[model samples]
Target: MALSLLTPNSLTKIPLTKLRFVPSLSPPPPPPPRAASVSFRRLSIMSSSNGIKVGAAQMTSTNDLDANFNTCSRLVQEAAAEGVKLLCFPETFSFVGMKAGESLQIAEPLDGPTMRRYCSLARDSNIWLSLGGFQEKGPDDAHLYNTHVLVDNYGNIKNIYRKIHLFDVDVPGNMTYKESDFTTAGTDIVAEDSPIGRLGLTVCYDLRFPELYQQLRFQHNAQILLVPSAFTKVTGEAHWEILLRARAIETQCYVIAAAQAGKHNEKRESYGDSLIIDPWGKILARLPDRLSTGIAIADIDLSIVDAVRTRMPISEHKRLESCQKISSLSSL
Candidate 1:
């Protein structure tokens, strides 16, 4: 099935029936206000201070750089026209499955054609953009890194986050991916200030680590977390939605994830349930699997975070005694 782009009006009315919620390990308190106000520089109507509209685009990219870029351009335009202030594209948005050694050949510099195209699109559409992982050329002609690039509406590069946790796992009887063989691991965690709110950036494999999201929300005060992924079909089907919802409910932040879907190259397939979860862990919007392209939109209310946190106050409940016991045992 081909993916569909949902408008704000249509998306707002989507019944919560389609939404799925994880049973929070701890029961959350009652919800706070249903809406809150927000403002954005480029998005005038969105400035009503009520809510911020964010979007996710699911894409299937191949070895052809030009074709993938064109598809992304169209989807960004469509989301922008629908009044999306922030949009996220799937991981490996530029080039997907080529030969193992071929990624270096397709890798581009940060300011090269691929980024330039995205910058132009951000400026033209006046939307904050986060394109999923791109193949970045490293030191020599042989090394590369899976990098996520962020661009503001003015077309300036806001930040770049290299995938910190590389996918180097071997799935039983299926596939083995050795990302470290070709890509360099990132050294730093990235969080940026934006017009909408504070944003935390992470790539696919980072989702498995809950500590990262905790630091992003509590330490950095991130209002929205961006996860761009190209999860394998086996892992994604088993853990994608559950892990995403768990992060949202635990952190009380909006979770926006863009994913690569459908079959790629000869035998590789990506799990395609691209989604946007609210602070309450409600699945606001989602795209079906096995599609070339699809878009999901949602209104993210910053006030909900405060309401949920205030009601539960779990983040503040700490047992220094228990922590001390664990630390003392480690010393032995």
Candidate 2:
């Protein structure tokens, strides 16, 4: 007997299980160069708290932490001014170094000045923040983790998801990065509560794994997914948009991806095109390519999640669990 896997319409990219994770590099979060890298509503197309208004920020984070904070401070103010309840930032939002190993020196503990600043922003603005990826000082003396954090509107932390999947790849002549060299991998999955809905936090490379998303959306009941990334130019152009839209469509949840754009350092260039996608797979708001520092805002409606899932019942029809087992089902 043989087992067969079923996939949705052809619009979906590679068969569900066949997709591979392609890794990329990120710039430091504090200053320009490369550092780092939401949804809703039927609210007025631009700004409001009438519904869930979210912001996606695209930045070129550099080696300087102070400079990067200035950029983030400005964007956070802009988002708050618009009455955005939640803002999603790209990975490495706090610090990226001139080179790879430099992150070791800059990595900070959760209570460090970098995180304190983020908490202050959320508290002052009364907004939730998906403070994507940061260089965290690991338990050991020599390593760091690509950590993702969720801060509530009142400036309290609700979740911390270290990147479970690290970006370690070789794009041959275009680029080759081994994130493991500078950062460690996270071991658990986080689907936590937020003002809008249950939020699932993931980083750049994690986008390629549909299984992880399945667990987030179905098992954990996450209604919105946040991917803060600093995807490299080569892969971002080829796979970023499609991957994001597909994830939204599959999970029937709002997908917010804030990305790193432009050249970050002499060694790296990020693909910018940060986006806010709806549950039905529409691109709601997106930052233009190559923008140095910009915020793309949009409305997010949770009702749409129910509507999409009810209309197309994909989760109910799936035959395989997140990790497929060859012998889970015997011959019919």
How many backbone clashes does every candidate have? 4, 29
lDDT of candidate model 1 versus the reference: 0.76
Candidate 2 RMSD to the real structure: 9.6
Clashing pairs in model 1, backbone N/Cα/C closer than 3 A: 36-50, 37-49, 37-50, 38-49
Strongest candidate by lDDT: 2
Off by over 4 Å in 1: 1-49, 288-292, 320-322, 329-332
lDDT (tens digit, per residue) of candidate 1 on 179-242: 9888988877888998767888999999999988888887888878999999998898678888
Q: lDDT at 74 for candidate 2? A: 81
Error of 1 at 204 (Å): 0.3
Native-to-model Cα distance after best TM-score fit, residue 179 in candidate 1, in Å: 0.2
Q: Least accurate stretch of 10 residues (summed lDDT) in model 2?
A: 14-23
RMSD of candidate 1 to the truth, in angstroms, is 9.7
Candidate 2 wrongly placed segments (more than 4 Å): 1-50, 321-332
lDDT of 2 by residue, 178-219 (tens): 888777899998999877888999999999999899899989
